[model samples]
Structures are given as C-alpha cells and as structure tokens.
Target: MTGSAGGRRARRLAIGTAVMLVLAGTNGPWLYRFGTERYHEYKINRPGYKAVNGHWDVVEFPKEYRQDTIHAVLLHTGKVLLVAGSGNNQDNFDAKRFDSRIWDPVKGTVKKVPTPADLFCTGHTQLADGDILIAGGTKRYERLKGDVKKAGGVMILYNENPDKPMTLPEGTRFTGKGNGKVFLSDDSVLIPRATKVFDRKTGRFLRNNPGYARVVVEAPKEGTRYETGTQDGYRIGGLTGADARNTYGIANKLGMDKRDFEGIRDAYEFDPVAERYIKVDPMNEARWYPTLTTLSDGRVLGVSGLDDIGQLVPGRNEVFDPATKTWTYTRHKRQFPTYPALFLLQNGKLFYSGSNAGYGPDDVGRDPGIWDVATNRFTRLAGLRDPDRMETSGTVLLPPAQDERFLVVGGGGVGESRLSTNRTRLIDLKAAEPRFVDGPRLAKGTRYPQISVLPDDSVLVSGGSEDYRGRGDSDIHQARIYDPASNSFRRVADPLVGRDYHAGSILLPDGRVMFFGSNPLFADKADSRPGVFEQRIEIYTPPYLYRDSRPSLSDGPRTIARGGTGTFTARRASAVRKVRLVRPSATTHVTDVDQRSVALDFTTSRDRITVTVPANRNLVPSGWYMVFAVDGRGTPSTARWVKVP
Candidate 1:
C-alpha cells in the first residue's frame, strides 16, 4: 500500500513540473508562444510587426512593482495625476504591483487602489463628476477554478480629490488614482463582452457630439467595438453601397480572425440625455482611422486616414453638420491624410500634417500634404514636413481662446512608416508662412497612452505597452512630464494601466484632463469586467513651481541646439518678420546663430508666435528631438528645420 501511494505522488509531481515550465515560459518557449499568439498575427502581411524595435535611455524611476507602463499622465497647477492599467491578472509589473494607479508627480510616490475582497473588475471609466467607474473586466476572468468557468460583472465606482486624494475612498485608496478623470458612467463606457454594472448603474457607452446627440455605434455581432471613424464624399461602405456599412475597417487584432477587418459608413449621432445610440446616414467610401475635429462652425471634419491594404487613398476629407443633419465629402488636391495632424488657424484655414510618411516608396511617403481652405490648395510645408509620413499626429492650439500658433509633436521619424514619430515639430500657422520648428523627443521608442498639454503649459505623457509583454508591460504608471519653457523633464508621477486604444482626452473646464480608456476587442473577460470600457478620471498637476513668465532678459543666451550639423548663422537672416514671430509674444528679437551669427532677442506685449532652440552644449537632452519656436512676431517662412540625434 505504501509503495503504491509513493508512485502516485511521483506522477503528480512530474505533471506539476511540466505545467510550471509551460506557464513560466522560461526561454525561447515563452518567446515563441507570445510571438505566435499576438505578434505573428500582425506579421501576417506586414514586416513592421516582426521588427519590434526599442530605443534605450536611462530612466530615473528605479523601483518596479513587478509591472509598470506609463499610460496617462496629466499636470495641473504644481501637481500631476497619472492613470495606468495592467494587461495581466496579477496587475503588478510582469509580477509586481496591482494594475491601477492615482499618483502624485511631485511627491515621487504612488498610492494603490485596492480591490475589495468581494469586488472584481478588469477595467474602469471616469466621468466628469470626479468619480471613477470601475467596470467590465473578467469579474470571472480568474474564476475558472479546476475546469468550470465562473465569471461575474462587478462594477464599482470611486472618487478622489486631486488636491487631497481619497486615502480610503470609503475605505481604501487607489494606486492609479491621480492624473486625469476616468470615464465611469455606463453611458460613457463600453464593455467588449457585455459587463454587469452594480450600484445606481454606472451607465453605457454613447458618442458625445455637438448636435447634442448621444451616438452609439453598436458592436458587430460578437464584435467588441474595435475602432470607429467617418469620411466625406465616399459611400458609407467602401467600393459599393448595399454593403456600405457606416463604419469602415473596424477589426479585432486579438480576437477571432478572418472577420478581422470590416468597413464603415461616415455618419453617426448620439443623444447624451437619452443614453441611446443612433447611426446616421452613411457619408461616402471606406475611410479608416479618420480624425474628427470640431470646426468653429460646430461642424466636425475628418481628415485623411487610410483604407485596406494599409495604403493612403484619395477622396479623404469629410464634413458633417450636426444641426442640419447633413454630411459633405470633399476630395482635396493634396496627398491622402494617412496619420496627419489637423490645425484650425484663427483665419479659419485648416492645416494638415504628420500622417503616414513615405520614403523608398516615394509615391506613398510623398503623400504628406497640407491643405489650406482659404487658398483651396495643397502645399506641403517646407523643412522636415514630408508627405507619406503617417506619424501619430495631433494639433495643440495655444492660449485661452486657442488661436494662432499650434504645436505638432512626434509622428514616426525620417523614412519610417506613419502611425508613430520620435521627434517633436512646432507648426507656426499664424506666420506669413507656416513652418515646422523642432521641440523635444520622446523617451526612447515607446509610443502610446497619448499626450496632452495641460492648461499650465506643461507636457503630460502616459501609457503604452512594451513590444512583447507590451500590454501588461504598459501599466498606467508610464507617465512623464516635459516643461516646454525650460526644455526639460520634471521627474515622474504615478499613472494608470491600459492600452487606451481609442480613449478620448477631453479637456475639462476646471483644467483637468478627462481620459477615456477603451479596448476594441470582444474578449469574454471584458464582458465580465465590472466597469466595462469607458472613461477613467485622474487629476494631474505639474511639480515645477510656475514663477510667472519671466520678463525678457537682454543679450541673454545666444544658442540653438540643432541635432548634429551645428547651429545655423542667423546674421544674414537676423530679421524675424514681426507678423510671424515677435508680435505674438509682444517680444522683440536680436538674432545670431552658432554664437557667431545665431543671437536674437525680442520683446512682447503678447505671447510670441514661436520659440528659438538654445545653441549651448548640453543645452537640450540627448535623444530629444529639438523644435525651435519664436515668442512672437517672427517670420515662420524662415524657421529652421533640424533634429538633435
């Protein structure tokens, strides 16, 4: 009897060992599985996926909660808030820390949001009301015990004061608390798989538009609302109309295959008060990843995105009038907007830029073109502004009213595919001639979690998964800050965890960033995850003590940091156009370049149109892309274009 028992024990031990090896994924075995499971799918037709690259740089944050990725970072006053999400059930980095956050940047420490013993959640959404709705994740994502799967939707909500974070919201504090507001209302969030909300009802997902319409684009049969976009002129469906689905190219990257891609129409409306979704008539052909911007007329214009086969197609621009319930499509004479940025000038002229950039395939890369409504023409901006460059681009209109100058940041790099950028570019559209100025580069190769400039002139960057373990690797804490005035990063803060694939960064009247984090996958866990996919709120304040704008110093520093070839001599071109540079900032200029010719000074009664790059050694951070901006009244037509390596 004893011998028989020993043999059985031995058998059980061997099996457990094998299981551990499989789960631990020691070496190539783990790599192979990850590659096959996710990366392989992307590598199916494109080589870009196979070349998952990483640019190295030293990071000051040393402690690892086992998991950490900067997802969303925002700054307010002298404080900062960060929101981060986790891809793994453990929530910690790879193997540490829980997956949620609400951190203080200046404090240099993080506070964790504890999961109630009886509560379960996978994701969260934030509402403008300052409460976080935790819903839709695998309430039972981990409920499968020894075979039987047990999943439940346990959505919960939490609120914290940005100035004084909730030390025990009701009882416990959240790790991913501060930074921006999380979307929590049922109407504001979406569950890939149907999620069960508890309490007074967290709400549902609806599209908020000017016509005061609450739009809801239903999920495809068994489809998790993967992506959404609209175009003008083209039929609702691509190629043909009968099959002209209003949404074009909405697909699931991690879900079921074959049905991975779908086309869509160009029109939609939502009724916020009613909490209902209604799809309007279709616009035109299939346009994927189109940018929707609200014009001064309260209309929305979607710029150049792309079609199937990953190519930039014509028939791109579309305009929608909510009041009139009408949508118009326009075919611009410029290159298709692959991943371009849209800027609305005070004069009402629209500026497009930073979309899928082209290179060896000149035809495609050369497609980066800018369209001017006033001139009704497409003229590519001079300098690094190239066609075919589909960088992850967006525009920032400065000041209270938001007019005149615009800031354009990273969108891929020289000769790289669009959708990503490494350097920052400043577009001075207010100048006689709009030009691209060099700003700062991002930390190494990481891309998403999105970036937003706060009301106080500070740059907030957050969230994005690492290549392989990229999802979980990108916790909400991957947050950082950049001070444009000093051209330097101001320490780290806590953030949230999640890919934030299609979340909207709405600017609140209180100056807080309204962050909406959503996943476009129809995974079962998302359904069971209590909060679903929607908004998550976090309040962020910068650490730098704003000492009011310093008065211009006479004969100060005479330097411009242009990547490698050294500074340009400003002597011959010392005069900056008052209409373009000096006047905006009410500042004047004394110009010279490389010390020998790049020194220039200016006075300003108003904010300058752009700023100049300092030309001193160690003047800027390495691996940082440099953008030169003037304070006010300078000729943008003569703005220099360069990047520091």
Candidate 2:
C-alpha cells in the first residue's frame, strides 16, 4: 500500500511540473519582464552598486499640496520656492488659480503660498538681500490657428500730437479705411506723444516723429471674411478735432492666424523669510518668457521676451533697481531669444551664451557674444558647434567661477523641428578671443538637459529628451558626472523619472541634487494621450554620499564679506581638501544664471577651517551662499549657510 501511494504522488508531481512549463511558455514575455525588473531593482539597491552609481528617490507631495512647478529657487532659509502660477493651464489661467509652494526638503513639509500673478514662464534671480526677483509672466495663453475664432493681430496706433500722450480704452474701435472692417482693442493702450524733431547741426525744425504703441485688436465677430489681406489705415472712433487728426491705426495682415502667448508687466520680489511675494514696480515692457539676470552693480537686468502684443520684445532691455524698487530702460538696446543664457563677467559685462529657450526669428540675436551693456556693443563669439540648434540648450558657468569658463549642453532646433544635437560646447571667456569649442558629446541628441554644479566641483548633467518636449516618448533617463578637471563625462546612475521641457535641477544645501518639473507633449510613444506635468520632485544622491561618512561643518559665521575670512568647526578638519562657496540656484526652463561654485582658499588647523572669499564682486555676487567643505575622498559636508554682504 505504501509503494502504490508513493507512485501516485510521483505521477501527480510530474503532471504538475508539465503544466507549469506549458503556462510559462504561453506567458513568456510577462514572466521575463517581471524577472528582469526584479533583478534590476536588486542590482541598483545593492550596497556596492549604490556606492558607484548613486541613487534617485522621488519626493511626491500630498495630493492637496501638489502643483505644476515651472520655476524653483533655493532660498537662504534652506527651503525651495516652487512657483507654478497657472502652470501653463489655460483653464487655471482663466480661473485665476495661480500657485506657489515653499518646500522644506529636510523636514519633508510643503507650504502653499498665495501667488499674486500668473508667473508661468517667468524669469527669476537671486537678489543682493537674498530675495528672489521674479519678473514677467503669461497675460494670455496661446491659441492655435485652428483654435483661433476671431480675426486679430497687432495694430500700431500712431500719435502725431507732440503736446500729450493718448490713452485708448479696452473697447476702443478702429474702422479700416480700405477693408472697412471694424476691430476692438483687447486692452488699454498708452501711446506717447510724438517727438518734435530738430536738426542737430542746424537750428531748423524737422518733421515730427510719430510715437506709436502696438495693441492687440480683434474683430467683434469670428469669420474668414473679416481677415485683412494688406496693410490698411484705420480711423480712430470716439475721437474729435485734433485727437482724431493726430491718432490713426495701421495694421498688416489681420487674420485668424495662431495667436501667441501675451505677457504681463507685473514684477515682484519674494521674501523667503516671510514666504510671500512683495509687489514691486512693473517693468517698462510687458514680457513673457523673459530672462532676469543679476547685474554687477546688484541691479537685475530684464531682457528678451514676448511683449504685451504677443510680439518679440524689440531689443528694448531694462534694469531693476532693488534699492529704489523702480525699473529704468537701459542706455542701449540689444535683443536675444527668450530666456537667453546671460551671465555676469568679471569685467562687469554680460556674456550671452547663445543658448535660448525659444520664440524668435532663427537668424537674429542667435550668436554667442560678449555684450557691453553700457555701450551696447556686442562682440559675437565663434566656433559654436551646431549653432542653429541652440534653442533649449543648457548653459552653465563651470565650477570655480573665477575660471570664466562656460559649458553649453544639448539643444534642439528652433520651434518644433525635429533637429537635435548631442554636442557639448565649452567656451573660455578669459581667452584672448573667446570662442566655443566642442567638448564631450552626449550619447543621444538631447534637449532641455538639467545641469547642476555639485559641491565637489563635478557637474551632474542629466535628463533630457531626444525630441521636442519629449515627443514620441524620447525622454532620456541618463545621468553623468562631468569632471571639469578632465573635461570628460562619466556616466552615473539613471534618473528614474524622465525630465524634458520645463525641467530643472538644483543642488541642495545637504550636498544632494533635487530635480523638478517636466512638461512632456505626449504620454506614450504613439502620442495619443496628452502628457501630464511631473509634479513629483526627484532627489539625486551622488556617489560621494554613498561612499562613506561625510564631514560635518558647524558654527560658521553668518556673513562673510568679499575678501574676508570665515571660520567653521569641523571634527575632521584635517581631512578636508577643498572648500566651495556655491551660490544657491534660481532655476527655470533649463536656464540658471544664478548658480556658480566659487572655489575658496582654505586652511585647516586642529578642528577648525578658515576660508577666504574672493574679492571680485562680479565673481562672488552679494547673496547667501552654501559653504561646503570637501574631504580628500571628494565627500562634502552638509552646507553651512553664509552671507556675502
């Protein structure tokens, strides 16, 4: 009886094994994927693997606190200011649901702040007092050609009267002299009085120069028949006597074409301590997608954006005086594409890196150059590879800002073209004739790569799409540590989340890097579903963090003036090899002109390390900076906040 039972059990086991094999054969792909994913998880989490390739962790805020963050700035208080401001959502903009959040990474807390305006696609930079100067934003969302219902375009209103300026109300009507079509202004227009011209050499009076204002106007009713084919003069309505004779409107080709996003003139300064925005003087020009760069004298330079009429700002730049809280037009006029990468030079000039976000004619203001802001003289630099593909490129002032070197990373063609380049260009502004030369190339053509300067002087270049806005699911998950000392890139761990357009990365005070924002065009390779904004912030822990215990810095001075010294206590001071004063980043849209790692001269004795800041104000702008002490093993201590006043 026992032998018979054993035989039956053995037969049953054989049958079960056969059935399992058949099931595996039918579901081979599913089983293979499951096994591969498990193995990958096991490999990446291993102690040895993490020590070499580092790791990435996603930080998802609570559902109620989640927002589509388009701009992020690291404040002196060690909290990140995430600004959304309608978040590129037409519905949110129409509903006036702007958003801002103060995220404390250390405490893992998120606080919602009331946003005053629609700051989407705005420009921001750190101020002398550690306040964030935020300028420009969306006034109206774009409407595609098919979506546009009314015939509308820019109408230039000319004022011939030299005695006074003219203010036209929102509903001001203009009737075309030729087409006989009537159009209404969408907003109030302030047209300055005409300039009375006189000959400079002779005392004779010359003809009056008309002062014009461009305003967006649309036909009251939607139809193809309302479109204008040629330039036409329009008669101003509700005007009499001299006003009617002096003011007239001229417009060309008013049609139901694609309407671009309009800009707002609103500007504000965000107080980090108070966690609120303080309204400041509006800019001279309404701008959308502008670049706010800190000037040498501590004033902020606002440049290059779509104007209130949805046209490119015509090279009219302005400056913001933080002390007076006023904006004044610059003595000169120079233009670039929107969000052009401009950096302050040691000589007080601005360096335009030829990297821009988008929206401009392809041939104009696209060259890398050294711009004399005061004189308005621009010396175009040469040797930039793939010059035509600079839109959406990432530019970085390489570590040790004193070197005056910059790196321009991957970019794509202007607008929605499929052209992209993997080339990385390096330019040494200190050279006799500054020009960009090719550096290491990326494995794949990339756009909107996030570059962060690490505490240890190595730059982490990571996350970009091979196509525009991550089209066709082309988000690159690769990350690399660029060694400036070697001028090479070493591939590191891959980021779990994909970052493309509208994405950026910031170096945290704790020596880690935090990445945020991604607005993809589609969800899948087939491009059927619309993409969602990546609200989950991802933190990258460098390989140095996983190697061994990091050094600790404490008891540091709060403020260290330029050319001054500050002492900090470190238990392992003798092991320290390098010190860096890294300015906190105000990053958005792959542009971060504020971030720079200035190498400091340091001497260690006993348990204390003293570091001296550079005297050059242009190199070390007056602001709060993260002081990091790196050991011989390239491991950096958690930063100590210090102010340069």
Instruction: Give per-model CA RMSD.
Output: 22.3, 1.4
- lDDT winner: 2
Candidate 1 per-residue C-alpha lDDT over 29-116 given as tens digits, one digit per residue, 9 for 90 to 100: 7767877868534543243321221011111333442223222322212222233333323343334333433444336454444322
Error of 1 at 175 (Å): 61
Model 1 residue 433 CA deviation (Å) reads 4.1
Each model's backbone clash number: 207, 0
Cα lDDT, all candidates: 0.34, 0.94
lDDT tens digits, residue span 1-645, model 2 = 356888989999999999989989999899899999999999989989889999999999999999999999999999999999999899999999999999999999999999999999999999989999999999999999999999989999999999999999998999999989999999999999999989899968998899999999999998989999999999989999999999999999999999999999999999999999999999999999999988889999999999998899999999999999999999888878999999999999999999999999999999989999999999989998999899999999998899999999999999998889999999998898878899999999999999999989899999999999999999999999999999999998899999999899999999899999999999999999999999999999999999768888999899999999999999799999999999999998889999999999999999999999999999999999999999999999999999999
Angstrom error at residue 127, model 2: 0.5
